[model samples]
Target: MIAEMAHLDVVVPPEIVDNETSGETTVEEGNSVTLTCKARGYPMPVVSWRREDNLKIVLRDQGNKKVTVTEGDQLRLTRVKRSDMGPYLCIAKNGIPPSVSKRIMLRVNFAPVLEVPVHMIGSPLGKEVTVRCKVESSPRAVATWRKEPGEQMIISSHKYNVTEYKEGFYVTQMSLTIRNFTLEDAITYRCVASNSLGATASSVQVYEIQPQKTRTSTKNDGDDSRLGNQIPLAASDHDKNDLDDFYNELDDPINNYLDPYHPGGILDNDRDREPLLKDPDIPKSPTGSKTFPYLNGGGGEGAVGIGSRWWWWAWVVVVVFWSVVLPGRVAF
Candidate 1:
């Protein structure tokens, strides 16, 4: 009897934490859930909860107040999302060398939803345009492109090109490219994103490009320096009279020397050389108004001098003509 009792004295190691992952606990979005976790051991282990993937656990209280619980049991989520489909950890510890934990996966199913950034899109003629439709669903959605009032599916063709591109984890983009868009391509196009759950659509208004008005730039007459292509306008009667007067005055060489101060008389210095009783301005020059250099001593610069400042006027005209004609002539 003593030998048989010795076998009953064998000590049993502590039991690791055990979590229940039973029958399908699939829950739809916008539903409540209460997952329970319990563990039995020699030391009466303590139970806790966490995300197995190290993500944050979102929970709600009685009043539907959102609370982020990092360390706790019974992860009660008021409204669940498809992201809550991942695994969660239920931990138990009782002075055990290695703590025990269990993983419970929550599955949530949702329908497809689609949205386009803009309702209206425009493209010019002879240009290619792309329309993007964003889709979101638990199961990957199959996007179909077509025009309004026609539920038929679109296939890859010469003019139209349909392609699917995933933008983010849950967001996918459906693009329809139309090459050389014209008035026929400018219509209300529809995109339908469908999954096992349901289907959704987004309408895009493609507007026909209107003819741009040809702008005729107005020429500003005041801008003279940059007006290389400026056309001359018809002169008025007053302009004609002024032009005729200018030509008539230029015809008389004597009028070129008219001075404001000495209107009808020779210059004072000129009068000193040869005094005249009559005015020089009155169409008829006084007798002996002409001063011939040969009559006087004509050799040097002073030899060719006139009675008044007429010599300087002639010198200025010669200098102007030489400077304009021989601009490249180097002077030593």
Candidate 2:
């Protein structure tokens, strides 16, 4: 029993740490990169990623102008650039002592690419037209069609209509149908295709209508007579002038009160009632001189009576007076 007096010591194994985790596993130039410091410990250890030289782990991409960083006991590099790439340390501590973690790597990839294509189809009156717009891209695209002048295109029940299709990654189609087309049916059509990157448009197609036949009628003697009968008898040139003069007199306040025949009797009543003058050789006065009896009242071309033979000098007096004084304001 004296052999049990000696004492012995036993060694224990280190506890397993947290699963490795990297903050912002992927990053872009001019973007902030955050590395997560997740570690395991018996009492939950504190974790952090630090630069070896104790210098800031930040890098500036002047060209891209971005920053990068991380959370959870990790280092954040803001506006990250190619220069920011280097070994980083992760430290963990449960108060027993601080422990560092393995470094994590982050890589950034470029964005997706996209493109579109323009397409067109022509149409005419009373006809159907087809058009297709195409799109090509790294991630595929979408295409659509609509009428220009107005949003919706009305298809006639009689014969025309439209059909649309969007299927494969590369192509799309739209069809326009026109029935019993008339000149009014002519119009321009357009198509459009687009993707995440950009959009494109097709050219306008103008529709033209065909011409139609027409008939015209000819005139005959009997037809002419019938038309003549249809016209009112009082619508003759003389009647027209009389009516016009009546209306003219109404409009002229200064002459409205004047009698159609007497017109204020500026000339004798016999001279005033005379008909319109006609071209004739000037008659010599009874006194045989060009200097005939001058009438004082003014107005031009009057005779003594409608049918009576009167001295031409009497009318000459009126003509000369009208020419000299009435031009400024011919009341009627």
Candidate 3:
């Protein structure tokens, strides 16, 4: 039994550590943290530390800490940020058996971020109005105005000529003057405020001008009048008589002249009646036919009716004269 134990001891490793140190770390910006690895082994194991991302290893020691490996074993980080939280590795090896320690994570906490102030400017209508926006955070914020659309914002330049003032945590102001307020001048004015964490935008304020009214005229029977006035009219004697004649003439032989080519035969005729010059509901005839056939055929025979009728009378006069003169001459 003794000989078997001696052979097994020769095969066993010297740096076999059974215990490890447990360290708790909480870090922040401009702060430091230390993680210690106290291990037990037969040959006094050597502790080595490294970062997972291949960063240069650093070590630091405090009071009651001796035989310090301040260059490779103990980790000391200064001015840590929230991003420094990760796994740190520590290994124990005595040139015999290698032992590893569980990873340690250092978390860095910080306060809430303070954002920039928001700037809002009202439009330049002669009408008076208020412009306002708000900012809230521990650290005070600086705000600016810009006109960029769907792009990185820039400060409002001097050319725009805006008046600016600060009110507590918020910044705002109205335009010095609106040169011209017109319908075409309406536009989306943007207000933006930013901080270290992020930026936000306010709803656009729009400017609109009420349309102006102008004088318009409406027609009445004898003269024009505004629609507001309801003039109870009394018809004149001549007007009543003219209207009565107009309606009576509508169905009379004067105006119901049916179109000749319009499939309807002639139904009425009156010499005293000629078609009214302006008929409102009448559809004009494309074929230039006249209402009276006698009028269209050129006064019967092209300007010869009167000459023919008078020609017979002229012959009678001439015969009577000649007969009288010839008989007297023979008697003499």
Best by TM-score: 1
Instruction: Give the per-residue lDDT of model 2 (tens digit) for 1-332.
Output: 35556666432322324464664365655678767666665566656556544545543333433333223565556766544544566666665544455655555322222222333333455665443344332223344445677735444355555565554323345554555655565555555555554666554544664546664545786687788889565658778899899977665543322322334633336454233111132222232222111321222233422222355567767898899778756765
Error of 2 at 191 (Å): 0.6
Model 1 residue 111 distance off true place after TM-score fit, in angstroms: 2.7
For each candidate, give its TM-score against the true structure: 0.52, 0.24, 0.28
Superposed model 2: Cα runs more than 4 Å off: 1-124, 137-140, 150-162, 165-168, 209-332
Q: Give lDDT per model, in order.
A: 0.67, 0.48, 0.46
RMSD of 2: 22.2
Model 2 TM-score?
A: 0.24
Ranking by lDDT: 1, 2, 3
The superposed Cα distance between candidate 2 and the true structure at residue 47, in angstroms, equals: 41
Regions of candidate 3 where Cα sits further than 4 Å from its true position: 1-20, 57-73, 112-332
lDDT of 1 by residue, 1-332 (tens): 35543344332323433444332366778887877676677566677777666776766455544334444445677788877766777777777547777777776768888889888989898898888888887667888888876766777799889988886445788888989999888888899888888988889988867769986555663454368665665678669989999977774434323331245423445553233324342222235354333222222233133333566668778998788756756542
